[model samples]
Target chain A: MKIAVDAAGGDFQPENPVKGAIQAVNENAHISVCLVGPEAPVRKELEGLDYPEDRLTVHDAPEIIGMDESPAQAVKTKTRSSIVVGLGMHQKGMVNGFVSAGNTGALMAASAFILGRLDGIIRPTIATFFPTIKGQGLMIDAGANLEVKPEMLFQFGIMGKIFASDIMGIETPRVGLLNVGEEKEKGSETLKKAHQLLEALPSFVGNIEGRDILAGNADVFVCDGITGNILLKFGESIPEALQTLLFAAMKKNQIDGEQKKLVGGLLKEAFAPFDYQAVGGVPFLGVNGISMVGHGGSSPEAIKNMIVNAARMAEIDINKKIITSIA
Target chain B: MKIAVDAAGGDFQPENPVKGAIQAVNENAHISVCLVGPEAPVRKELEGLDYPEDRLTVHDAPEIIGMDESPAQAVKTKTRSSIVVGLGMHQKGMVNGFVSAGNTGALMAASAFILGRLDGIIRPTIATFFPTIKGQGLMIDAGANLEVKPEMLFQFGIMGKIFASDIMGIETPRVGLLNVGEEKEKGSETLKKAHQLLEALPSFVGNIEGRDILAGNADVFVCDGITGNILLKFGESIPEALQTLLFAAMKKNQIDGEQKKLVGGLLKEAFAPFDYQAVGGVPFLGVNGISMVGHGGSSPEAIKNMIVNAARMAEIDINKKIITSIA
Candidate 1:
């Protein structure tokens, strides 16, 4: 299967995405990559890399969408950008899927406008992997629709459930609505209506609170994009905040550097399993085609994983499952 | 000023509340407390304590409201419950303030019903202490109003600012609208409107993302109840989650018990300064009277601090400042 990778994406640009695409093709015999970027830089980054020549190729798309540019404006103006061109390839069946670590807003905007929505999809959502104690949990609407209708959330549940089952390998994943309280009639009007609608699914768990996010209470947590985005960002900040507090305490207590190093090492070790970098990218589910967006600071390995995951998503034909489920 | 303590409130019950009132009066000579609960049990618990007899007294309030009871229903039925009776006393000018560690919803309902809202207050908000690296910040609408209008959030910012400046001891606290993005036109329609309204205040800081919460970017973080409630619950869950993950990692690495103990001790010390228990209770800002609610499992020390804080709130007359500012 063919998958297009945005080499002009992420903080590392062509280097990480270029190397990541090469690695994915080298590791997966069935997979071939079309790296979309400025040809000169892409080739220069690929100079020392050894790979299966026939399985990997480059597509020149000189324009770049910056991380700070207006998503809609950037997509409109930068038609030749890698994100635009890569997804265009997928839209026309030139590639089976497209992956990028570029601007999230631009990617989401471009994906919806270019590929259109899958059948029965009200609004496509950004689904993110939540690090939980027991295992990984998937949260949908991770900053797509700001204000969601009840039915929209119900659809998110379906999309999240399919993604979790097909891609993340959690069969019959328990879906929970993220709310203020655990009770059925909790939260805003939108959440209340969403709860009633989500009850149609046998795997639907009742409302889960913020405390449940990392407690492994639900496999798939559904919420409006605002809550999900805030939760995702808040979750990302915990390690740094804890470390700051920990260091202050260590200094005040006059603990020796050796002990501090030991504690620090232990912290890093514990956090390793739940690191965002290791997970690579998250999918903007409910889009017509497979489109994944990784972190801006994604490593080559993470980029590699994103490409492979994109291929796996296409192989499973997740959109068809989502369409059927939501229908 | 006279304050009433809920003897039937909190997990520790009459013991903690009884001793806490004694400690508050003992420590703060200007403050006096009336312990409110079932007369027999409260008086019996208060026996043998060497408190200033004139400064400390017990008031009869026989009915008990369970933590799990429906808040509005419980307030309507359990008229003589401590939360109800204590607020009633404040309403009747018998006490200057009331403090409880009982059901949050029940207290909010009863407080609003009994004491009423301050002049020009749109919706009374429950403002809780946000523990940041710099110090304690206050987040308003912490599960009081589920769906907030733009004007209501603007009022929350004003209430939060007054509470922070008067009670939290910050001068001109930086107030921010908690949102999904930092841009001016970001988030839902309500947030954008709220941002425009908040611009009237000189202390207003534009939209703050989820990452800014723990980093101490703003002293007064204002959002709708759902966001604030979720953020509060999520913050409360972090330490326990971290500990669980840390233990599993330690077991995996086979770290010695002694080192684990040392690391654990350091973690606890660091977390102590930011402990919610240490902060005691948070105020239901915009309420006509001073009303504070502590943690369910509040210690005697926490209860003492809550009572003292409640008295301080009365002394500062924070509601008057809120009314003045919002007007």
Candidate 2:
């Protein structure tokens, strides 16, 4: 299987993406990577790196879509940009999947414009993986469509269920509607209507409250893009806040250096689950093909994990299962 | 100078309320407490407690509103319930304010029904106090009105600004619209419209994301009740989830008892800001009179803090300021 990497995208540019591509190709025997970017810099970064010559290759795409550019306009105008070109390759079936640490909005726009949506899918969604007490859960529409109808939410549940079952290896994944309260009568009018639709599904676990997000109440939690986006960002900020508070307390107490180190290590271990880099990238579900978007500040290790995740999705044929399920 | 306490409310019932009332009256020289509940149990709980006899008294309120009862129906039918009787006292000018750890919906209903809304107030919001890195900030409409219009959000800003300046002592409070993104064009349709409305206000600081809740980005964050309610509950659950995770890790590492106790002490100190009981209660903003509501599981200390908060709100005459500002 072949995966395309948007080397010119993200804050770190070609360095992290090139290094990640090399690592992904070396680690996965069945997968090869095509690094897409301007040829000169891409080749220059690959000079010191050692990898199997046959497994790794470069696809030259000169134009670059900036992070600050308007997503729709950028995607439309920057036709030869790495993001558009990489996704275009996936559309043409040259690569099974694509991964980028680029502008999220541009990636979503390019994906929807180039690859289009799956059959019976009204809109594409961004599904983020969250670490729960038991293991991991997926939250869909994590900033894709801010204002969603009740029908859209019902579709999110279906798509989230398929992704969890096929890629995450959860059988009959429990789907939940994210709301303020657990009761059916609670939440907005859209949620009230969606609650009825979701309840008809066999795997539906009814409404899950915000407290239930970290409590591991369900396998797939579905909500509108606005709520999901806010939740995802808030969850990401927890570890940093805790770290600042803990260190401040230690300083105020005048703890010994050795004890401080021990406590720091314990706190790091405790907060490992909250690290965004550890989880790699989140997949944009409901798109026609496999597409994953990582954080703009993703490290080489995080990029590598994202590549592996994309490869896993390609291997599992998640899109096919989603298409079948949504039908 | 007098505040009514809902003695039959909260999980601990008459005991916590009675103890808290005693603590409040004893601590505040200018404040008097009127415990509203069934005379028998309330007096029995107060018998052993030592307080200023003249400053503390029990008012007979025979009916009790259960936590699970419907808010509107209960408020209408259970006219003699503690929540109703307590707020009625405030309505009748017998008390300056009222505090309850009872059913939040019922308290809200009774407050609105008995005390009514301030002039030009579209809706009475529930303003919750959140401990930020730089002291505490307030979030308005934290479950009072789930679905609100753009005009109502504008009013919320006025109310939140007045409450912050008059009660919180922030000379010029920064107001923010809670949204998915910081860009003016981002978020739901209602948020986009609300964004334009908030921008006209002198204190409006543009949009604030969910991560800003703990970062102390704004003095007052405004959102619809559903989003605010979800954010509040999710914020409340963080420390509990962290505690569960931290203890599991300690047990796995087989830490000694002394080390465990020391670590626990440090963690507790670090997490003290997250404890709702520490902050006391949140006030129901925009009402004609001072009304505060605590968590259903509030302890005696929490109850005492709620009474003190109510006294502070009453002392500042927050409602009059809000009325003047909105007008």
Candidate 3:
């Protein structure tokens, strides 16, 4: 199997991607990587690293799209960009999957433009994976297409369910529609109709409230891109704020001895040692080929995990299943 | 000043409401109480409560709305319920303000129906307090109206700013439109238009990210009812979940003994012990009269706090100020 990595993507680009590709090559001897980026920096990171020469190769690109760059403009203008080159490789079957930590908009645009959307899909969605109270759940369309219809949400649910089963190892994951209230009649008119349609599905768990997401009430949480974006961002920001609050609280205590210890101890226990960035990329499902988009601040470990996740998706032929089911 | 209390509202109902009203009376000798609910149960709870005979009175209402009842349906059927009676008293000038912990939907409906909407206010909104990183802020239409327009959101910002300044004593509270990202152009079409419109406002702080609410980026976070409801519930549920998670972790010795104590201490420090239900219930700002809707989960302390808040609103003539400003 072949996988393409956008070496020029993300904040800690070239270096992290180079290290990640080396790690993926070491773990999966059967897989080959086509690293896309400006050759100089990519080679600089790989200088001291030893790897299986035959399994890793680099595809040089002249320019890179920035995080703040417009997706459409970048995809249109920077045709030689790493994202475009990687997507082009996937389209030509030179690589079965593509991974990037670049501009989310640019990644989405390039994937949709080059790989194209699956047959039954309206617009491809960005599905985010998180460790919930019950375990791991996938939230589809974390922030891809803003204006989504009922049909689009249905496709998201279908894709999310398939992704959960194929990647997360859930045999028949329970799917829940993220809503304000549990009542079927509650939420917007769009949601009410979507709920009715989702209820007919076998593994549908009805409506789950925002509070229930942490409790991990559903294996797959579905929503339109707009609401889904806010929900995903909201979930991601909580641990971040909690950490800041804890540090400030700890700093506020000066004269305390046992009291200080108690405060310090509680702060440590409250936070689980989860390297959120390590869970880096989210899979942009519903595309013709597998595409993983990582965070801009992704570290080497996170990039490595993202590559592993991409390989898992490729091993399970997730793209084929999504196209078959959602199509 | 006269404040009406619904003795039959809240989870604790008659007992808490009676105790709260008695406390309010004891604390503020000048305020009069018109206890509205089932005569027998309310009187039973207030049997031994000693206060000025002239200041204490009871109005009989025999119906109750269950917490689980649908808001619209409850308002339509439970005509003689405590919430309705309390709101009616406020409308009739028999009381300066009304408070209930019965049902949010019913409270909003009854307040809109009895007291009516303020000028230029197309729909009544449930404005409640939010605990910001700096202090507490107010969010309007917390869950009053689900699908909202840009105009409604703009009104919420205007009213929320005035509310924070007049009630909470924040000078020119930084008003922010709660959105998915900080980029001025980063949300739905409605949000885009709202941003454009808000840019014209003198006090608008542009767009605020989900993390900013706790980061203390803005004094007032404004959004539609659905988002506001989700955000509020998210805030309430997260801290509770984290607390539960810590306890479970501590039980298995997943954390050390000292760490357990520290986590517990941090949890306490992180959460404020504010009785939101009794913080004078959710005030239906943009209404003609001063009416507050308390959560059914309210305890006596919550009811007492709500009564105090209501008295402050009445004493300052909040309704008149809001009406004049909006007009």
lDDT of 1 by residue, B1-327 (tens): 899999998888889899889989999999999999999988888878799999999988999998889999999999999999999999999999999988888999999999998999888889999888888899888899989999999999988888888878998799999999999999999999999999999999999998898999999999889988988988888888888887887788788778889888888987775577777998998889999999888888989999888888888877778788888
TM-score of chain B of each: 0.98, 0.95, 0.92
Indicate the DockQ of the complex predicted as candidate 3: 0.51
> What lDDT would candidate 3 get against the real structure?
0.79
Error of 1 at A195 (Å): 0.8
DockQ, model 1, C-alpha based? 0.84
Global lDDT scores for all candidate models: 0.90, 0.87, 0.79
Off by over 4 Å in 3: A247-270, B248-262, B273-280
Interface RMSD of 1: 0.9
How do the residues A1-327 of candidate 2 rate in per-residue lDDT, one tens digit apiece?
Answer: 899999998899899999989988888898899999998999999997899989899999999988888999999998889999999999999999999999999999999889999888889999998767767899988989988888889989988998788777887789999887888998889999999988877889999987888888998989888888888888888877877777777888887588788777777777778788767788988889999999888888888888888898888888888788677
For candidate 1, give the lDDT. Answer: 0.90
In model 2, which regions exceed 4 Å deviation?
none
* Model 1 CA deviation exceeding 4 Å by range: none
Better of 2 and 3 by lDDT: 2
* Candidate 2 per-residue C-alpha lDDT over B98-154 given as tens digits, one digit per residue, 9 for 90 to 100: 999999999998898899988889899998887677667888888989888998999
lDDT of 1 by residue, A151-259 (tens): 9999999888888988899977999999999999998889999999999999899899988988989999999888899888888888888889888888898986788
Residue A173 CA error for candidate 2 (Å)? 2.6
Better structure of 1 and 2 per lDDT: 1
User: Chain A of model 1, TM-score against the native?
Assistant: 0.98
Which candidate leads the pack in TM-score? 1
